[model samples]
Target chain A: MNELVANLGVSYGDVLLELSYLLAAVFFVVGLKFQSHPLTARKGNLWAAAGMFLAMLTTLFLHKDADGNGIALTNGIIIVFSIAVAGVLGAVIARRVKMTAMPELVSFFNATGGGASALVALIEFSNPNNSSTLVTLLGLVIGSVAFSGSLIAYGKLDGKVGDIFAKWTTYLNLFLLGIVITIIVFILAGNISYDSQKLLVYGLLVISLIYGVMFVMPIGGADMPVVISLLNSFTGIAAAMGGFIYHNQAMILGGILVGAAGTILTILMCNAMNRSLFNVIIGAFGGGGAAATHEQGTIKEISLSDASILLSYSQKVVIIPGYGLAVAQAQHICHELDTLLEEKGVEVKYAIHPVAGRMPGHMNVLLAEADVPYEKLIEMDDINPSLPNTDVVVVIGANDVVNPAAHDDPSSPIYGMPIINAHEAKNIIVMKRGMGKGYAGIENFLFFNDKTRMLFGHAKESLQKLVNEIKTL
Target chain B: MEQAFEFFYANKDAIFIIVLSVFLGIEVISNVPSVLHTPLMSGANAISGVIIIGGIILVGHADVSKVSVNLILGILAVLFGTLNVVGGFVVTDRMLEMFKKKK
Candidate 1:
């Protein structure tokens, strides 16, 4: 009886930690599967979050030091304070920030996350205790990359900086990276004492931070989604390093899972945008000049009432939505317009490019929320064919995705990325604030087309006005 | 049946928390927009900030010999990952609110 009891005495905490990890993994799988369809996305998110929490809890409870204490009292205090500060700050921001600043707020948070990681690495190197060559090297690479990369993404998303830095910026980064590498080599050469090693590590940490900043500084606003994914991957890798440092199985497994998932997501986002990861990086490398915004002075314009008249007579219609839809919070109104058009016996379908909004499938979610039927939400492949059959394509605050670079200009920033081909439709009606360049800072050829008519205004107001005109008709 | 019951008795805390968190997380994410993938991810990138505090605690408490360096480095890693999580959550929430109709 005692032998059986002893066999089972292997402590419940370890078993629980492993079990929690399993649950977390399950949640990750479910969350990822639900990403393509909005109907299941929220559930998917919750699953992923649950998984993360499980992983975090496992780490919290399972960690044991040499003295047999579960976690030091100081460690517990730190955790409490960190949670309190972060939770309060998060709540305040959530309560106070306007919908218009939501995207910027999100970007800022991402940057802060990256900065925290890099700072952690710095503190580790600064410490007199727990020095290992392998752990230091891992922290150096992952922490630095995540920190600078996230900041640049934040800057681009906020329009604080443009993608594409000065021509020499790339070279400068290369030079800085080289110095850090050489220093690492020197430390590993076995000639340096402990104090010297600390200095070298500190120097490298500074360079790593700069590298992270430089990496993101040049990426254009349009590619922020991909950059975010890439940074997420870096953070995961950094966490994995932390796991290795602490010899924590849960952290290692969780970090690796996050890293792998983030890498896959970044690739998918890049593919959807029809651009290579290399191009995204180079695009971020800004050249010194006037911003690369597309502003054509010569496009013909039309009134909403005239737009309504044209739509009233058109045989078929395609509706294209972009960030402006989200900004204007006009998705429901847009859906209303679509319904009215369909009622008039004009066939209507929504055209969605993969990278249409700030996120991968943004337009679909916003439209779905507005009660647009699932079948009406057409992907790039499905909608392009219908564009030629359509008599009118009403573009609501979309720019880069409608630009003709996919068909005509090879040198353009958004070239080769799949677009909605609204230009091929008999008539185009674009509702926008003005002829401002999109996230890519390039001109759209669709605006210059004879069939294209700019219905200049905020998407919601303009859409409301169009709805009124349609009702009158 | 005895082993199963015994396992449940021994690991009740772990099982309960895991199950409950999974249920809660699933419920919250079910309503958020799929487009939030990007912003959530970016926000997660921000959560990496937590690693910094983790590093500080780890290093500050570590023995001044072998693990000290590792703790400090670990803290950095935690910082980055934490930042990502915090930021990711913030963005996810913001993106979800976008679906909410304007007042």
Candidate 2:
């Protein structure tokens, strides 16, 4: 029956594999598309994930042996166990990690992917029967470079290496890279024997690792997010090379898509940081003289009830939550404020920056838990346009993401990275217990913006008071 | 019928790897944001680096008739693999250091 199915120009396995790939691709496209806008982004992600699951299941079933038994059952069991262990580790980290460290964790994961693909290629190459053609060598070299490069990027992102290394490592790396390439070319020209070629490959990998280390050493902590995106592109390219060597259409296509998407993101991140990709690579001029210290001037503190009353009267209110909101677990309170505003026919939306709340999507998950309608969550780009229309931008424990220094002060640590334009709103209301610097340890200029008002107290307490005032009014 | 089955056996490994990687990739995409992609990629790269182990195993059992070039290449691949593993650990350890509590 299976043979008949295979011959009738209706190979069920191909149909299933193609369908799975199609679905995964669809999901990838949709999810990535929605990532730019927070409104429908969560649903977009769920859709993408559903597609991926379909792909996984279909592909698994298609890999059956002639007797319809699954191939490598023992290997499959081992894989499941490894995945379980990894899952536990990931969950533990997610639960325990603060919002701030989320980016570094993401960087860690990107490094892992690059390393995995490189290792896979290496294993394949070790087989004597495998062809040692240019294609195989290309795959091996590219994958190795990406693996080491991404690991170094992860290290730098974690702040294990100082920003100064990013400053001076570029030229030295370029010099070494030149030597590695020269040796590789000489071997390829048959000027060296087979042993020499092997030595050259090792030399290439060593140079690549050193290059990776030097590449990321100089970048400032502030620019880590962009670096993560760039490294992600490298991983995708390495995977594609593996795909090429293996002659898998799905791997090649999927890898190509990821590589392209990652590259675009890297460019966008670079633009956001206001630095050319070249400059970021060289780790030019990280930190110092950029952020101005505000005068320890009189800070007027408003009560929660007064703040709530002020918020209710506004035609439009934009809630900006920061790390403090995450620390206080005030997402639910913020959600309540949104509901009350909606009941009063007031327009309410939450403005979120990419790096807002410590992790990549910390604010999204927190707000999602509070049952905040996904559509009401606004990303930096969308919120920037709406800030002018907004009557009140109610900042809940936010600081760095809203700092105007990104635009006005080139000397600040966050000079070029994209930020939420909450300062552009008609009125800015900040809720905090006291004046403290943001993650970058800099005072916020938005706090002193002419239209800004500081409401001093715990974020949840303040929001609850505001909710009460709205209820009464 | 037996010959048809033999063809399947001959091509099974290639088919298996292709099917597995694609499926795993889809699962990864569906369940998580690309944020975790880095670690996954790095892990895979590390696995590919295991070619060095394969090389060592092959070299240990290699017959005298085998090309000396293969042996040299095998040694080089092993060296690269070791460097990749060590470098990966160094970098990852440095990154994990960020989570340490500051005095």
Candidate 3:
């Protein structure tokens, strides 16, 4: 096979490799374009996977170093075996992960990619023939930061980690960041002796890892989506550095694309909450301060039968869902109620707050799993105008998004944050396990409004009872 | 310092590709609806797995004579990169599969 390939000319093999990489790049672009719409999203994923397969196959078979040596047989076996085992492990974990756990899973995957890139940089830096120290250092530092940072994000999302939430953490983070930059500059200045280069590189790696941890330590849980997005961008840039190291167009394009996607998401999440990225990074929001001390008003309870009757008689009803709905795993039952209400001549729609649930568009995915109609899921801005005309607004396992304090209570932490106008509707019925405070631990002033009626129960049970009552009516 | 400039001069094409890709990426992804955010993110995450190609190249050239640093790191890189690629795509497909129009 080697003799045949040499007979075919080394330049021909290089041409084949480059052409395959170009084709893979095209596939990625088309796949990303297709992902913008729901109907083609799954097909888009397959297309991108095909591209990945082609790139990996071509690299494994045709890759040649500057001396024209193909991969040794033993090394090839190692590569194939590692890929096969890791691929199976990855596919199994992804298939088994619950939809509610998707955010953390994404974080975990991002960390792996970052780790791979960082390792690549580490190996290259130790190579005798390495030329681009700057690119290698960058890939090493950025990839290390992304890897450790994402793991912390995963731990936080899994409820295994707690926020530090101290004033000094911010200054500490900044100080560490300054040190990282200073070290990078010092190494690049070339004043350090060659004997200490290895030590400096390892030191940079350690400091970057520490910086990554501190960077994420103080951020509250509510800002996780943004942090995840930002770290994802870091991984992408780090991968691009690998591309720069090897002069690989596929890696370059792929890295930039992911970097852009993560940036867009980060900005979108920030806009959804009416908060700046700086504010989110500084960890000043969603800390659950003294907002709960003020007495609001008397609470009114509503019976299941009355709730059913209210739904049955309403001309139009809007459902506001939150992380609570996800926790109770009530999305399917919630959908059942929506279907039942629609059959009773009541128009039903779901109002989705951008920051609702745990991640960006988290509630939509949950409802989609329950097979809710796509058209019925209205965005917060679009649904707010129609809310005043809505006859009934049912708040299910949700609080802060509809708390009204976001709009009226300037003293509230969530004051300027956008919320679904569930308070504006004629009648409000809130389903909850109890009068417990929301994830942010802020008091929901909507509960005290005259139009509001509390229906206390686990979300799934309450939704089931409401469905049954409506059926009987 | 001279070496840095030489590096840029040698890889100008790669730099151009990076710049153009950034704009194209922003353009293609800007209009994705909120409903598809999770899937879109996961899909992009999978694409970052393109680093797997780098891992393969490294592993292919590694000195495998008795557990060298190159061989170990190369194998680990391939493993992690493959995991990111396969897991990211599979999970994304799972999410998108749930997003069917009401039947």
TM-score sort, best first: 3, 1, 2
Report fnat for all candidates as fractions from 0 to 1: 0.22, 0.00, 0.86
Cα lDDT tens digits, model 3, B1-103, are 7876886788789878888988988899887787777788889989988899999999998778888877788889999999999999999988888886564
Per-residue lDDT of candidate 3, residues A63-174 (tens digit): 9987889888988898999999999999999999888898999999999999999999988888767777888999999999999999999999999888988989888888
Give the clashing residue pairs of candidate 3, or none: none
Interface residue Cα RMSD of candidate 3 after superposition:
1.1
Among these predictions, the greatest DockQ belongs to: 3
**What is the C-alpha DockQ of each candidate?**
0.14, 0.05, 0.82
How large an RMSD does model 1 have? 8.7
Q: In model 1, state the lDDT of residue B95.
A: 52
Docking class of 3: high
If the candidates were sorted by their DockQ against the true structure, best first, what order would they fall in? Answer: 3, 1, 2
TM-score, cand. 3: 0.93
User: What C-alpha lDDT does candidate 2 achieve relative to the native structure?
Assistant: 0.58
DockQ of 1: 0.14
